[model samples]
Target: MQLTVFPAPTSPTANLDHGHDHGGCRTKALQTAEQLCNNRGVRLTPMRRQVLELIWESHRAIKAYDLLDRIKPTTGTAKPATVYRALDFLLEQGLIHKVESLNAFIGCSFSDHQHQQLLLTCIRCLEVEERPAAGVMEAIDRELEQAAFIIHHKAIEIHGICIRCAKHPPITATI
Candidate 1:
């Protein structure tokens, strides 16, 4: 999966949600995170930040179940509701987005900006990633016009095995 571990310049800065952050990147993301939370009048509780951080740490999209496993405390365990609520809040704020096909979520790289997103999922590996497809919207518009239909916000996603998967068999079979 293409993780793009670091945030791009054009996107609203957020703490990396994946593996680990070093140097100034983490600081910038944390600052941005605080600002966003303040502006939205939402509390960035410890649990919430931890969840978001875990998502940022990996460049790849993460399933909620996997995330729960990652974030479960060493001493005790977190309940499903805990992870679900944090994810729900993050999604509501547009700080992250869900890839319906993969049943996974990724940090919103462009949280501070406005744009539509399209996801490309690797079917075999089940990796989820996104790219901006402004032109695709125009094509979609044409298709929709032919159907004489109106559309709401659209999240166009394609699912298939990626080149990596095609070249190298995964250790485990796909579900």
Candidate 2:
């Protein structure tokens, strides 16, 4: 099976930062999640809302344990199972994606559309940018048909240094 990988630009002017109105994005995402749950006859619980809010706080991939830590203050008795359950719910509803390479989760920028996820992860800064890989699903389906393979889940992560990191490396302390 042939997979097309797009390289992130290394130029200084390349908009490596996935710029979005943070507050607006979060509001829209929460609204979308609520609508999706309502339409599917599922409840968007308070804990789920908290978890989604934490995930949308940044565009970077966040680990489950980290989420658990963050939610502890509010939900004093929060546990791993609780976070995992919320994460699973979000994933099922297409509200978030798991970054396989980083073993972390990121909020889906385009949750309304059904498409294969193409993630660009920065190795240095750990920033993740998601884009839709059109035709990728069809291509994979065609290949799977030829090989008689059944698919379960799919996540595509492309790792490379981001433009900011490339332009300015972290300064090391010299003795």
lDDT of 1: 0.69
- Lowest summed lDDT window (length 10), candidate 1: 4-13
Off by over 4 Å in 2: 1-20, 167-175
TM-score, model 2 to reference: 0.80
- State how far residue 167 of model 2 sits from its true place (Å): 4.5
Model 1 lDDT per residue over 1-175, tens place: 4332222222123333222353244345556777889998899888888888777655467789887887776416788898999999888777778887668887776676754687777755444556777788788889999999988777778987666556665444334
lDDT of all the models against the reference?
0.69, 0.81
Residue lDDT tens for model 2, 97-136 = 9998888998988888764578999876667888776777
| Top-TM-score candidate index | 2
How many clashes (backbone atoms < 3 Å, residues ≥3 apart in a chain or on different chains) does model 2 have? 0
In angstroms, give how far residue 126 of model 2 lies from its true place.
1.1
Query: So what's the TM-score on candidate 1?
Result: 0.68
